[model samples]
Target: MIVFQQRYPVAFTIAACLVCGSAVAQSAIEHHVWQDKRKFEPYSRTAKSITGAIRLSGNPDFATPGSKMTMTFGNGKKVGLTSVGASWRQWDETDDKKATAEAFKLSRDPGHLRNGNTLCGDPQSDPAQYVVFLERSTFGDSTRLLGMAVFGSKEVPHDINSQSLCGTFSYSTD
Candidate 1:
């Protein structure tokens, strides 16, 4: 197991491998976000805002083809770009920053549907592009699946669940 703590961002990341008997079977990533209310203390432990875990296991023989699973919180909120019907290359990867930038531009092309501040695009017509832009502005550098939270609050974050997509994409509040 490996653990890394970042001070400024108040993030704690844990990477570990699971072993059954003598052989390792799976690896997991656990991330925790903390909100500090201390002024003098730099490393003050505070209330935890979120906790996320990603685990991968099983063999190809037992794995289902074309199967995909998106992460969701205990509050019934979906996490990561996949939740918004976007791919890793289109949103988080450093190698595909160009594609990510292009998607941000096209999202505000004036033809896309708008729900409050978010921009909704057609995932079919624009493959690799963001199907749902949470906000009208450009995507942030720090914004990624690991660092993002959706529906984290008791109040509805946005109307994306109610707004119609390009008909190819669908979202649910439940």
Candidate 2:
């Protein structure tokens, strides 16, 4: 295509509109840095989400019983996080299943809360909300509490932002 838009004109117009097919409704995190800038790709949308065994928040007796979690959402759901520590930097806004992710479900659910604890009756969050520590904590209390996320506006389920978001959060005991 004209030598890739004269040698990469912004990654050839975003990879020629994602390979020029038309029907574009995709973005669970797919940025080839505009094109081959590498890293960041998780766009598998056949609407596949079925689940069980999603434990995060650590210290559940040294957490070791069918653990798994993977998550990333942007461009519409807009959230992909992982700071790697600080008990995921608590931010508990009276818990509403962590405020999003469709009331945090799929069966056996109990993982979502970035209300970032204001301590005892929590209120007053935003501790640099940008969490994405997918399925961590194999004991030793590294505390990367499963699939928690935040970046742009995590005020809580006061309304909007919850389209069953998940890249691949697996933790099945079935």
Candidate 3:
């Protein structure tokens, strides 16, 4: 029989392997909207708001022991633009976004979204999006995300389980 330490070089190796396996076998994405804001009239003084959170369970095959498993957003293909911003580029990549929390604050700033007249198109309509990234690693790093906890700007009850009228959410597994 092999000793416990001798059997498993790293105490958490088994747990980490199991976690990575689960992600590979059944990866999933859950986007929960906690707040949302929109406006049909750009010139309007105020705008509707929507906020939400996203959870991802992904497994990147062939990842090394010390490699990283980060969740990054794809760049826009059309117009040769690669970015996750609300600009003149097509809206393809604008839908699926991920970035550091600090980057998302640019949109959540009350004053920024309030300036609806600076819309890309359709002066009568304005849309804004704010998404934050959550990273996981194969090196036994864990992120304790208990679903998304978005705060509603309205005075309504803080029903975390309730869905908001935010953008569409899609879930897929590999």
- Poorest 10 consecutive residues of model 1 by lDDT? 38-47
Model 1 bad stretches (over 4 Å): 1-22, 29-90, 97-174
Cα error of candidate 2 at position 49, Å: 12
Clashes of each: 0, 14, 11
Off by over 4 Å in 2: 1-82, 88-90, 95-129, 132-147, 153-174
In candidate 2, what are the lDDT values of residues 1-174, reduced to their tens digit? 798789889998887787774556655542111111112322122112222222232221111223222232222222222222222222232233331121121121212222222111212332322223223232364533233333223322222233222233322111
The best-first sequence of candidates by lDDT reads 2, 3, 1
Candidate 3 CA-lDDT value: 0.24
Residue 67 CA displacement from its true place in model 1, Å: 16
In model 3, which regions exceed 4 Å deviation?
1-73, 77-125, 131-164
Candidate that scores best on lDDT: 2
Report model 3's TM-score to 2 decimal places: 0.18
lDDT of 2 at 27: 50
